[model samples]
Target: MIELENLSYTYGGGELLSDVSLRLQPGSFHFLTGPSGAGKTTILKLCYGALLPTTGRLSVFKQDIARLDRDQLALMRRRIGVVHQDCQFLDHMTLAENVALPLTVSGQIDTAQREDLSELLSWVGLGTRLDSHPPELSGGERQRAALARAVILSPDVVLADEPTGNVDWEMSQRLLRLLVELNKMGKTVLIATHDMSLIRAAKSQVQARVLRISQRQVQLAGADL
Candidate 1:
C-alpha cells in the first residue's frame, strides 16, 4: 500500500507534479495514464522512493518515505516490485540471469528457487531466451523478461511502467493476465501506460481504477476503468 498526499515534485527547477493525492490499497489495481512528459514516470518514481517529493508527503506501507534511512528504504523496496519503462537489464548477463537477478542480489536465490524461476520464465514465454542476452531479445521478449524479474520475489506491490508498450496486442493481453492474476492473489498493482485500448480492455476483466495524469494533478479517469 502506498499513499501520497498533496504531493509535488520539482525537476530542473520546474514543477513536474503538483497537489497530487492518491492511495493504493491492498489487493487493488490501478492504471496511470498521461500524455508525454506529463509526469507519469515521476509519479511512479515517487511511489517507489526513487525520488522524494519536493513538497507534501508520501508513505510506503505506512512508513514516511522521507524519514526512512538507506537500509529502511532498501527493505521497503524489496516489498515493492517495479518494472521500468526501459526494461533495464544487464546486457552482459543472459536473460534468465537477468530475470533471476533480483533474488540473486537479495541473497535469497537457491537451487529450489531457480526451479521456480524457470517456471516463471516459462510462464512469461521466455523459456527459450534463457541463454540469450538482453540485446539479443526482441521488444516483446524484453518486456516479458522485465516483468518476470519484477515479480520474481512475489512482492506485496507491483509497479509496472509502460508494461505493454512494446508488445503486440496478443502479447499485451497475455501480460495483462499475469498482472490480473497477481492482483487476484491479493497483491497491489499499479501500471503507467498510454495505451487507452489496453485500459478499455481491462475494464471488464477487473475493477481497475484508471487514474489519469493531466495538468500535474491525479484524477480518476472517467468511466474507462
Candidate 2:
C-alpha cells in the first residue's frame, strides 16, 4: 500500500500539486482523474517513488520514501508496476523481450519464467506478436503489450497513466476487465485516466474509488465520474 500525507510539488517556479493526501489500502482499486496538465502523472510518480515530494511525506508499504537507500528503493519498486502514457520499448527487441524486461532486471528470468512469459502475452492478447518488434504493432496492440509488461512481475501495486487513451471503446473495456480481474486477486491497482466514461464503467463493475485532481489538490471525485 502507498500513503501520501500533505504532499506538495513545485516545478518551474510554480506549484503543481499542494496538500495532497491519500492512502491506497491493500486490494484497493483507485482511479485518478484530472484534466491535462493537472499533475495526474505526477501523483502516480510519487506513489511509486519515481519522484520525491518537495514537501510532505510518502511511504510505500510502511517505509518512508525519503529514508530508503538506492538499493532499498530498487527493491521496493519490484513490488510495484507502472504503465506510462507512452509505452517505450526497444525497437530492436521483440514484444516478449520487452514485456520480460522487468524480470530480467530483477534477475528472475529463467527457463520456467520464460514459459510463463508466453502465457502472460496470451492473456494480453499479444500471443501472436511475441516475436514482433515495437514498430510492427498497432496502437492498441502496443498498449495491450505494455499492460502485459506491467503486470508480468505480479507486483502488489499497479500504477497506470492514461492506459486506454489510444485504444477504442472495445479495447478499453478489454483492458479494464483485465485490471479488475487483478484487483479481485488481491493486487492494489491505481490508474490515472482522463476518460470519465472509462471511470464510470469501472465503477459499475468494481468497488473503485475515483479521485479527482483539481485546483492543485487531490480529492475524492465529486459528482463527476
Candidate 3:
C-alpha cells in the first residue's frame, strides 16, 4: 500500500535517509529496525505524509505523496493509523475521549456507536481504564491505550514506532498479540523498533518481514535473525 522510489531526506547538511526504495504490499506486516539516528522514524514520517522527502518520490495507497495538498494528505492519513513512540495524549481528558479524538476531528463520530468504542477499548485491554486520565496510566497501559486509539477508526494501515519500548516482557507480548490480531483482520502493519528480541518473538506468530535501516540505507533483513 506504500512505495518509495529513490527517496532521500536531508536535514541540517546531513542525510537522514538515502536512496531508500521499497514497496509495502497490502495486508503485509513489516518491522523496521535501526540504531538511534538511523532514520527509521523519518522514513515512517515520509510514508504517512507527515514529512515530505527532500528528494525522490513516495506514494501511499497509490497516491503520489509529494503532490497531495493538505486536505488530500488528511484524507489519506485517515486511512492509516499511527502510534508514536510517545503516547501523545491530553492529560486532562479521559482515555475514552482520547481514543475517540480521531472520529471527533474527522466529524465521523457516531453517538449510536458507543458499543463499538467500548469494544475497542476492551480489545486493547483498556476497558476499565477508559475513565482514567493519561497521567494515571502505567507505561504499558499508556501504550495499549495509544494502540486502541490508533485503530478505533478501523484504518486500513497501522504504523507504530517503538510500540513496546517501555513495557515489561509479558506486557510486550500482550501488545504484540493485539497487533497480530489486527494483522489477521487484514490491516497493513509497519512497526519501527530497536528490540531484536521482540522481533524474534513475533517471527513464530506471524508472517512479518524485517527491514533494517543501517548506514542511511534500507535493506531487507536476513534470516540470520
Best by TM-score: 3
Ranking by lDDT: 3, 2, 1
RMSD of each: 1.2, 1.4, 1.2
Model 1, C-alpha of 7: deviation from truth (Å)? 0.9
Q: What C-alpha lDDT do the candidate models reach, one value each? A: 0.89, 0.90, 0.91
Q: Which stretch of 10 consecutive residues in model 2 shows the poorest summed lDDT?
A: 216-225
Q: Write the per-residue lDDT of candidate 3 for residues 79-106, one digit (tens) a residue.
A: 9999988889999999888999899889
In model 3, which runs have C-alpha deviations exceeding 4 angstroms?
none
lDDT of 2: 0.90
Model 1: pairs clashing at backbone N, Cα or C within 3 Å = none
Worst ten-residue run, lDDT, model 3? Answer: 110-119
For residues 62-107, could you state the per-residue lDDT of candidate 1 as single tens digits? 9999999988998888888898868999999988789988888789
- Candidate number achieving the greatest lDDT relative to the actual structure: 3
Clash tally for model 3:
0
For candidate 2, give the lDDT of residue 39: 97
